[model samples]
Target: MTTVTARPRAGRDPMRLPVPRRVRLGLLVVHIVATAAWIGLDVALAVLVFVPMLDASWTAVCHQVLPLLFWPLLTTALLSLVSGTALGLVTRWGLVRHWWVAVKLVMNLLLVTLIVVLLGPGLADAGRHGRALAAGLPDVGEVPRLFMPPSVSITLLVLATVLSVWKPRGRVRKT
Candidate 1:
């Protein structure tokens, strides 16, 4: 059973919450840490994807290393998403209150969705190809496809980071 209260459209105190300050801070910390980790892993993946293009031997190393990273990156993405959403709900920054926050939310969701649906399978296939190449199997396909999403995602995450810090104006108007 739950009780519903009418929330004022414009005058609601964003900080009026059942959550404590430290808890909110903890969530923010976790969100930041996870986001940073996610970004770092993506950047590393981008580099690994490029390394083989420079030195053929790196292909074996990349394949051996990349598969091990899948779980950590996935965990970080999920943590950042959950913690960020919780922060938005609990703090003055309502989910859709400000344009930047809304954009961040949408972008983050897209990134996470891409990670789960597109990037995972693509990387797995890339790893398989890399392994085959390492074993002297001829004619592995272009590796660029494996790198594209993370490259784009890195750019997207950077934009999101900028939005978080800048927090430009333009709040959504209430009806």
Candidate 2:
């Protein structure tokens, strides 16, 4: 007796598990919401940073409130990263298969790393300075360049969003 087994279709890997349509949709929603939230946080931060420039008296208040956004910003960022990664893995675009997806992934990773390594500590220091300023203490030093972080993050995020909508590049060539 002989037995026959079905083979995967051409260009499809047998080991690659298929994701359900509903699950993919869910992931897409999560990714969109998280990305939007991250952008919103950056916008708020940008406003706060700008306020200090317009009115020096608001500096202490802005700095004090800026630190509070750290956790939420980090949370949204992480969510965006994870959802985007999962979407890439399960969807046809793949994590690194398509050029646009690959670029977005790299951007997300870089943003997340910057948030953890630079933004987090910077916000904490700002909070401390704000407290010192509020207490009328001398030698609080100058506030760090708060504009850079949000400005850079927003730019990269908007670029990523544009890439998602345009999907400009074709698939990366297999080496």
Candidate 3:
């Protein structure tokens, strides 16, 4: 009778499973594209928020543009998270194995949460108040709430991208 080994074959690394090459490449491409899309969308939203400050005349147009961003941001955020998770799982970079991946995962999750809980509603409120402001009503206490979060999100995303590229040392040892 032939003996069977419980562990992975001698040539393969234990943490890095043998995923098909094409699948790995596809996942990486999707992850990268999604990340770019997410960052782009956030930056666009930031610009839109700034428009009203730059020109009071543009308030109505900004209000119109802001609502359109909601869906793209939501979609790209979800795709980045899912594709990144899959990449981590299928590659040598197990999700929590490396500090960078773990941090990115947490950051992305927080970003998603912020998008859902804070940013979306803030945008809607800002749009409503913007319309009112354009109509010559008092300001809507809008400066602090809407302007800051998108910048913070963009910063976090850029940080995550740096961590991904740098892949700094600090691996979580398995117990």
Candidate 4:
């Protein structure tokens, strides 16, 4: 009996599959654009959060407008996450291969989780409250704190962007 082993092709490493440069570039572009969109959405939300302070009646209007942004915000966040993960997997960085990439992956995951679990429901509640306010009903006194979500999201996103740009840390040492 003979045992045979197949070897990698000439000049190619079996462990490192080559991803097309164009495909990687496209993924990078998508990741960047999606991240920028998410940041923009957060900025818009922050601006809306301040509206109530300026005009009390605009509070209902701002809250009503907030729900409309939910879908777009979610879409952008998911796009950024998916594209970033794809880029990391396809490129030299294998998701957790590098410290910066790993940190980014964690931040992205956390942001997405918060968006789904907290932000979505908060937006819905704000919309409902807005509707009630517009209906002339007495204030239910449950003013949803809208500032924190966007503020926190923006901060994390900017930090992620910085990590991406700086790529400060080296690869994670294998145990």
Q: Local error of candidate 2 at 70, Å?
A: 1.0
2 versus 4: better TM-score goes to: 2
Model 4 agreement with the true structure over 32-140: per-residue lDDT tens digits: 9999999999999998888897889798888888898889999999999999989877886678888999999999999899989999999999899888888888889
The count of residue-pair clashes in candidate 3 stands at 0
lDDT of 1 by residue, 25-93 (tens): 999999999999999999888887888778877887786567666788788989988999998888887
How far out, in Å, is residue 34 in model 2?
0.3
* Best model per lDDT: 2
Q: Residue 157 deviation, candidate 1, in Å?
A: 1.2
Tell me the lDDT of model 4 at 95: 82
Q: Write the number of the candidate with greater lDDT, choosing between 2 and 3.
A: 2
* Per-prediction CA RMSD (Å): 4.0, 2.1, 2.5, 2.0
Residue 44 displacement (Å), model 1: 0.9
Q: Least lDDT summed over 10 consecutive residues: which range in candidate 4?
A: 9-18
- Candidate 2 wrongly placed segments (more than 4 Å): 1-6, 10-16
lDDT of each: 0.83, 0.91, 0.85, 0.89
Instruction: Give each model a TM-score.
Output: 0.86, 0.92, 0.87, 0.90
Alpha carbon lDDT of residue 143, candidate 1? 55
Better of 3 and 4 by lDDT: 4
lDDT at residue 124 of model 4 (Cα atoms): 90
